[model samples]
Target: MAEPSITIRDNGPYVVTMPVEILDAKGNPLTITRERITLCRCGASNNKPFCDGTHNKINFESQVSA
Candidate 1:
């Protein structure tokens, strides 16, 4: 099995490699149909928990490395 990976995009979302499950606050599962997923980080996406390019519109900035 391949290990999952996660990448943080510049001023954008968290790009996640799948075979993973995402649960809502209510513990309900969110449908994941893609090989990878883009999760919101800037808290501006109308589509909560997913990236809708709101970070670009809002000019969100972040510096992180690991």
Candidate 2:
């Protein structure tokens, strides 16, 4: 079983990137890929679940966790 992982970038429009396999409720893989994905953290992206450089206007801040 391969575990999925997400990476958060500080200098990019995407707050987080993850290689995911979309699955059904029963854990069946859907039509998804293992490619890198960008997620919006500023909550102002017209494209949900993806980053569109909307964070620049909102001045989003992220706290680094140790």
Where's the lowest-lDDT run of ten residues in candidate 1?
1-10
**Candidate 2 lDDT, 1-66, residue by residue in tens:** 335566566644443224455556788865545455677666788876568887777777774444
Please state the error at residue 6 of candidate 1 in Å: 1.3
Instruction: Give candidate 2's root-mean-square deviation (CA, Å).
Output: 4.7
> What's model 2's TM-score?
0.55
Q: After superposition, how far is residue 23 of candidate 2 from its true place, in Å?
A: 6.6
Q: Write the per-residue lDDT of candidate 1 for residues 1-66, one digit (tens) a residue.
A: 456888898878999998788899899999888888899999999998899988998999986788
Alpha-carbon shift of residue 54 in model 2 (angstroms): 0.5
Candidate 1: lDDT over CA atoms? 0.88
Q: Which residue pairs in candidate 1 have backbone atoms (N, alpha carbon, C) closer than 3 angstroms, thus clashing?
A: none
- Against the true structure, candidate 2 has what lDDT? 0.61
